[model samples]
Target: MHDTDDAHSEQESSAIHEPRLWRDKGWTARVIKNEDGDGWAVEMIRDGSAEPALVGPWTMGRNKVDPKPLDATAHQTLVKTASEVIRRHEQQLHAQLNKQCSIETESGSLTVRLVVTPDEFEPFGTLTAVDPFGDVIATVKVPPDFKLTRTRAERWAADGFGRIQ
Candidate 1:
């Protein structure tokens, strides 16, 4: 009755969609012809990104004309390597966005930090100073591309923690 109709609908829906070429561990692997050289390359793209997270050389078959077909083991390896690439990229970005510098101030050793918050409309940054005891002394909004250096940190602290325009 109604159950049979529902089952038929589900089967039709499944049949209408084409199977994915390659999917593993939240990533998709695609092999493309190398433009620069006479070989092939593989690209690993994360689930939601149009750009590939990682692209590298792929093995050639014995005929030396075509790329070897992707298999389960190759997909797993590509996924692992792509995940690592994404992880490293994130870590590098985090380090660049958040910087810390130490300077000797009259009061004591002060820690200067520059934290950047990226936004689509307007990116913002903050320059902060903390005492040796981890107490925030001052925080000022700065340009998102502010660079934290020892000399700049000392200057900011010596200027009474005012805006460094």
Candidate 2:
């Protein structure tokens, strides 16, 4: 006979398709009360995540007071939307932490890249200059808020790649 704990674990791991809840394909769709209004809302949460990736208004049922029952099609749509939200958020964060520019120097053209490390205690940025042949000419540690523009890269190159004030 299976133990009670094992049975509970098995139930949790299996797919659930209830009217207000649907869990499958590593995502869960749940209908919840809208705190901001009188209507109902649906939230999509990825498995193992603590918070929902997407939440929006849910359609009303025929009676007009209750929310529409969750279906396979609705769950799939929610998963797609929630996945897109996470992807876009990651892209935005990457853009914020990494920057690149090209500048012409006396020696040759160099590509300057600034990548910021988001440390909790000591956030910092690394400024790197690479030649056209992909050789790193110079690298320096800078403050996380350092802006990397073309003009700034040219000035850094002109300053002998020393510490920036």
Candidate 3:
């Protein structure tokens, strides 16, 4: 009886959680708008997963008009919805957080910051602005660039540019 109960609990637990595999499968998470553009859609990708699963778009609920912007709550909901979709289509995935690089580069006399995130959907990598100085810039999606070297980082700082890369 104990074994049966334990097994039941395991099943119930599995029903709710999915391992993050998008990172390993090279799939990236993207939020798209529904046909109406008033809702959101979550997409999962990989070299080979079952048919594309649709993780219903989050709507503005009852407003029947402009959809709300995705915030932390929306983001968490999307992750759960999308993870469930992937679980139904494939085995547990082993996704990894994208590796990141904060690089400093110079553009003339000014300082520039570059950040990159590597993921499956973006098999190449991403680039973005970290900062010119003194503040956190917008978090953005970027492709990773291995070309960013240490010399470039130091040179950039000396050149008067700082990077969040």
Task: Assess each prediction's global lDDT (C-alpha) against the native.
Answer: 0.84, 0.94, 0.45
| Arranged by TM-score, best first | 2, 1, 3
Residue 152 of model 3, lDDT score:
52
Better of 1 and 2 by TM-score: 2
Candidate 3 wrong stretches, greater than 4 Å? 1-33, 36-53, 61-63, 92-165
Where model 2 places Cα greater than 4 Å from the true spot, the runs are: 1-12
RMSD to true structure for each model, in Å = 5.9, 4.1, 17.1
**Residue 115 CA error for candidate 2 (Å)?**
0.6
Which residue runs of candidate 1 sit more than 4 Å off their true CA positions?
1-20
lDDT of 2 by residue, 29-144 (tens): 99999989899999999989999999999999999999999999999989999999999999999999999999999998999999999999999999999999999999999999
Better model by lDDT: candidate 1 vs candidate 3: 1
Give the 10-residue window scoring lowest on summed lDDT in candidate 3. 16-25
lDDT of 3 by residue, 27-90 (tens): 3344456766546555544425554454556455356654444444444555566667767644
Candidate 1 vs candidate 3: the TM-score winner is 1
**Which candidate ranks first by lDDT, i.e. highest?**
2
Q: Write down the lDDT that model 1 would get.
A: 0.84
How high a TM-score does candidate 1 get? 0.80
Which model, 2 or 3, shows the larger lDDT? 2
Top-TM-score candidate index: 2
